[model samples]
Target: MTQTSNRIFDEMARLMNDAAGVAQGVRREFDTLFRAQAEKMLRELEVVSREEFEAVKEMARLAREENEALKARIEALEGKTVAKASKKTKDSEPPTSAPEA
Candidate 1:
């Protein structure tokens, strides 16, 4: 090949390599922008993160368990109160007298 044609080919190859590099850089920048925008949108929507949801779920579970325990404790106290009232009533009542002929 002539020297001029070889030079032209080398110039074209260099241009193509530079264009490819620029395209790659643009793609990376676009990906970064898209991810940032997506995260911002999610935040605006008030979306809960997985960690926050899990923590709230666990707290609710614990609260439900505590409520059940309190209910049981109240029932036990009610039973004791009723028993004491029954004993008091029995002790206060007088004995019945026999009937006349």
Candidate 2:
């Protein structure tokens, strides 16, 4: 009776090991399928590559920096022009004589 029980336990253990192996294989297959589907979806969605995204981001950053510099330059030039115009106006004005009461 003990011998029979031992044989049954051994058989059960073997079956469990086989089931574990099958589960692992199925998990691998599912992983592969999921990856393929994800890649296909990305392609369909027209997702850009990482490098392309980074390049566009960098371009935008550079453009912003250049715009800021140009704005500062324009402000400086306008300030100088305004100062020169005010000086000219002051120099061209004639002095008025005081009237006697």
Candidate 3:
């Protein structure tokens, strides 16, 4: 009787172990399927990856900085031009003396 009970318990333990293994395998398969589906959806959405987004963002920043620098240079050149024109006009004008004795 004791031998029969020991055999039954061993069989039950073996079945339990097999069920746990199957459960793990199913979980792994489900994860793979989920990941694939998610990737497909994202691709269809045409979303940009983080790396590509960062690259474009950096490019935009550089363009903005260049634009600002160019604006500053234009302003400086215009100031210099105005200064030169004023100086030239002053030099060309004749000095007038009022009632020279």
Report the error of model 2 at residue 35, Å.
1.1
**Mind giving the per-residue lDDT tens digits that candidate 3 earns over 1-101?**
99999999999999999999999999999999999999999999999999999999999999999999999999999999999999999999999779868
lDDT tens readout by residue for model 1, 1-101: 69999999999999999999999999999999999999999999999999999999999999999999999999999999999999999999997889998
lDDT of 3 at 4: 100
Reference-based TM-score of each model = 0.66, 0.80, 0.80
TM-score of 2: 0.80
Local accuracy of candidate 2 as per-residue lDDT tens digits, 1-101: 99999999999999999999999999999999999999999999999999999999999999999999999999999999999999999899997889999
Ranking of models by TM-score: 2, 3, 1
Instruction: Candidate 1: list runs displaced more than 4 Å.
Output: 1-27, 96-101
At residue 40, what lDDT does model 3 achieve?
A: 96
> For model 2, which pairs clash?
none
The C-alpha local distance difference test score for the whole of candidate 1 amounts to 0.99
Q: What are the lDDT scores of the predictions, listed in order?
A: 0.99, 0.99, 0.98
- The whole-model C-alpha lDDT of candidate 2 against the native structure comes to 0.99
